[model samples]
Target: MSQQQCACPKCDCSVDSQAIEKNGQRYCCEACAIGHTDGSTDCGHNCQCGK
Candidate 1:
């Protein structure tokens, strides 16, 4: 199956098989799923989409 992009509008990372699902949306990490509540855009990955 093809990987899906993160649900976050600013995130360009791809969601793997273990993608984090929140409210029926798939995210690359918790930060994306929570809409960067802490004002942090880092998803513990290399990409700096939220920067």
Candidate 2:
């Protein structure tokens, strides 16, 4: 499969096999998948959005 950016609008992290799926959308991590609704500001990845 091809790589794609996280579903989160603020995140630019790429997702692969570790991608987190939510409602048909793929994210880099759980944080992004849930739209950081848990008060998280990052996806726990080494990316600009997570910084």
Candidate 3:
């Protein structure tokens, strides 16, 4: 019974199996989901990406 995690490479948030799926990757939030589509890990806000 391990909890699933977001598929965003730069994200460390936990996600459910029914979380947002994009391009076969699971994202905890919309920012992570959209950011991943553009190859950006910034999450569109002040994050580790520094953008």
lDDT of each: 0.85, 0.79, 0.67
lDDT (Cα, tens digit) per residue for candidate 1, span 1-51: 699999988888899889999999899988888888878858888766666
Worst 10 residues of 3 by lDDT: 42-51
What TM-score does prediction 2 earn? 0.82
Which residue pairs in candidate 3 collide?
Answer: none
Worst 10 contiguous positions by lDDT, candidate 2: 42-51
Q: What's the candidate order when arranged by decreasing lDDT? A: 1, 2, 3
Residue-level lDDT tens digits of model 3 in 1-51: 356777766676777865788898877777777775565556533455313
Clashing pairs in 1: none
Candidate whose TM-score is highest:
2
TM-score for each of the candidates: 0.81, 0.82, 0.57
Tens-digit lDDT track of model 2 for 1-51: 899988888898888987889999999887777777777766666554533
Candidate that beats the other on lDDT, 2 or 3, i.e. the better one = 2
Model 2 sits at a Cα RMSD from the real structure of: 2.0
Candidate 2 stretches greater than 4 Å from native: 48-51
